[model samples]
Target: MTTSQRWISTAINHALLLGAIELEQTDRGTRPHRLPAAARAQWPDPQLLMVEGQPSGMRLAFRTTATAIELETIPTKRIYVGMPPRPDGVYDLLIDGQLARQGSVSGGDSLTINMSTGSATHERGAPGVLSFEGLPAGDKTIEIWLPHDETTELVDLRTNAPVEPIGTNGAPVWLHHGSSISHGSNATHPTGTWPAVAATAAGVSLINLGFGGSAIVDPFVARTIRDARADLISIKLGINVVNTDAMRLRAFGPAVHGFLDTIREGHKTTPILLMSPIYCPIHEDTPGPTAPDFVDGKLSFKASGDPAEIAMGKLTLNVIRDTLSKIVTQRAATDSNIHYLDGRDLYGEVDSAALPLPDRLHPDGDTHRLMGERFAALAFAPGGALAH
Candidate 1:
């Protein structure tokens, strides 16, 4: 029997939205956000705008009896100015908490970004439709994970049966924040990101604040984390601080303290895990201002700052790790709920040898899986850092 379909707008009441702090309704459609409007207004850097626009941990989840469904979206794909063309961002379909299909939209607008110049150009394209046919009958949970790397605008949703949002029902909420590594940079799909994988393993709802090239210990971001409703909070810091050369040793400690202080205001006794950076061979001993090298149009990062700058207090991965360890230790002495996890425990030298970072910065899909599994084992496992 051919059931009639009805189009529905993407509204908060109709679908469960995770990780996003706000929704920007535009002529194109509604765009989910990780940072609130106030934060965006404060730091209107184009890089922050671009990274936040990408739905790192956003998904549209609902319960439906539909046998067939279609969703229209306008994906703003990013193209690094000099790099080769990249594949379309993937959309993941999950039914009853299992991945059912992986697909990509054929047409969409493009955001051409010049990393060196920190400028962007937009190229218009048509909206793309994603269709799923022959879904299981009866009430079933449906989740469509947005592409982690693209700025996606929800256009419309169509289904043959009625749909409604599903409530959390007391599920533990895990709020996470980090750098591009946690933003699903080189992951295979949206759920394949390390944080997503860990969240699934831990059986907790996730709110990921990982932003590509934008997790620079911003006060507004800390405030965002402070205000979020999370039972468990974990922050993976330091990579972006080194990559952008955003701060020196003099300011790094105080900045981290302030960020933590802000989060502690809302989550007084909530379990907070402070994680250092993962193993990055290039930035381990070398200072950064990471520079990209395009070899045959392939993107790879290299440490551009001098190693000698360490004496001058220029931050490096090692410096950040030491500082984070000290800070967590000092705080844990006063606060039992706070803990520390060395990111090397998640992805260290041995793991890197087995599953190396493809871009000299972000982990590959395999590494993401490994890191996610490892993180779950360490933090969520019994007697672990974040374990209650």
Candidate 2:
């Protein structure tokens, strides 16, 4: 450590953390989790465990006079067995509420997965330091947004000057739950995610519960949302359920109703916006159990379920959207705060033609930005469902 630098352990200062639902005390340091310990314990699927710890909307916020800062973190990066190595997760630094700089940590733990075999291997590596030097002098609010896709355990935080936690700023909190699209798949950075973008534009604090492949309307997830403090709540459904083929029409409707029932148990009159899936040509009409298609060395996804089965209750994007719309309309009769939004309105056929999803499933960086802008306009504008 440098002679002028004062090192601070995140383990001792819990107040500096923001956006995470829980802070897990790890062997290396503290790891932020989007899901609570009890919820995680209830459903310990490996995929859910990894995504919940990725900290999509989590960041470290403090007020400091430091001219430079350094953070040591051990990040668990994911790797596919055959595809090219993914780039290191980007760390975005905001000074006085504006993005000022970006950085990334190099080597750390790696989790290699063989998707075809449904197997993964973890390799431990040394912690890497992310350094941000030569900041503008004087007291300022600083925020370090961690990687949205990586599981990071913060080891140390060091700065050239004294730092103090920046407590709640009295902004309304928006709690959103969805699948990978909201979890930030293929987005360049954490703030680039649609939910983050919408939160910033809407002038609300975000608590993202967007797990990649794990947003299948689990009871525990609904219970977590029931207990959270939120001024606005949105649940983007359909994509994960269709892709995983976890439920059929017979069970999907009641499962969603039950999920909403649990949330209403706590947030009786809070505005709830229920959204369906966006335009994905591959799954729009086809049922899934989506499967990865590494065609000609490039990754893509294809629906594997037969279309004929959809008549027998297999869920498709179209079917799910219709179901969600009907459910919301039926509930809005007695409950005025419940609302429904067609995900296609956010990214419809027109959008698909203009900015096609690079992977036939997840949107690209540009699309993410576009979707965020569209959502902000649709939901946060005056006379909108979530408008204040």
Candidate 3:
């Protein structure tokens, strides 16, 4: 079998298989294209080598703030990445970054990062950040840029390159799911994905389920996430649910209930964080029935679902949240384990200025970095993995 196919098969066979991911063009390539020969030897860890093929021009360097972990085990945390623009068609995995067993690029032809699936990213345009963990646990800078093309120079001045290490645990697993925003569109590389940023800030594992326009509370997705094991977990709802215009009020309630219900079935008591959605001026408080061509200035939208349905208050995020609030309130009574976090809290209107998504949909890497740090502060505590 091809290298990419083998890795996909090993999804079950391999325990360390990446879990969370936000994919674009679900029907794209199974893996990224091959790496430039030189890049192969350099990027060895999966944490860093997110593009396709081999790990050539890639290198690791670091800057520390508090204490450092003596750079051991591929400084997994905060592995930064940046890539030049590419045609919006298909591509392959260039090279293997930090931790790689064996994989390929261009499986589906689409480009994205399956943070949990051990997949590679297909560059959209420009250069952005890529992150790694296992840092020395101080204010550290890390960068990992991969692109075999001759016209790209990836660099990270704000944060240091490579990364120091904290030398703890295995590596935090990050699990995420959302709409196009979460799928790494417009962002430069897999490391630039918000989940990646968040993963770095909080220093935990990631399992991104952020499908480009597919996070409509699919029972299968929930089941998939529930079954996957990880040290941390999160789900970004609202935007996708509302944007897709999936379900009405009645259905939204049950869907949320079922989604969480299934997750609880698997996670039970794993600090499951339920996030709302970020601020998109066009759809902030508006209802859906979202058809294409709805715009509030430069902000253009497709209304997501059926407007008639939204008029009924059945397909709006507000309505969904209200229902979720009620469900969680009640569920919290019995299921104290489940936690609800308003998505607005993460990226509300006020944040629109400081952390603007160049396209105004997803959060940029810097914002993602902030969100991750906040999440770690709120979700994690001193020493232990989860919050008390």
For TM-score, the strongest prediction is 2
The lDDT per prediction is 0.87, 0.90, 0.47
> Per-residue CA lDDT of candidate 3, range 1-388, in tens?
1223211011110121133122111121122222222333453544223332211122232234422111111111111123233332111121222322111122112344443444655544333223222335445433232322111222222222222422213665656656555655444455555565556556554545555555677676676677666556667777766665666676777787899888878887776667676667656656654543424433334445444556676556666666666777878888766667776666677788776756546566577656655666666656323553
lDDT of each residue in 1-388, candidate 2, tens digit only: 4666665544325478778888878788887888889998997998999999998988888899888889999988889887788888999999988999998898889999998898999999999999998899999999898999988888888877778886557778899999999999999998999998898899888889999998999999999999988889999999999889999999999999999999999999999999999999999989999998876789989999999998899999999999999999999999999999999988999989999888899998888988999999999899888997
**Residue 317, candidate 2: how far off, in angstroms?**
1.0
lDDT of 1: 0.87
Question: Global lDDT for candidate 2?
Answer: 0.90
Candidate 3: where is the Cα deviation over 4 Å? Answer: 1-17, 20-169, 289-311, 354-357, 381-388
TM-score of each: 0.95, 0.96, 0.57
Best by lDDT: 2
Sort by lDDT, top down from the best: 2, 1, 3
Off by over 4 Å in 1: 1-15
Per-residue lDDT tens digits for candidate 1, residues 225-327, read: 9998888999999999999999999999999999999999999999999999999999999998999887556878899999998999999999999999999
Residue 386 displacement (Å), model 1: 2.5
The TM-score of predicted model 2 comes to 0.96
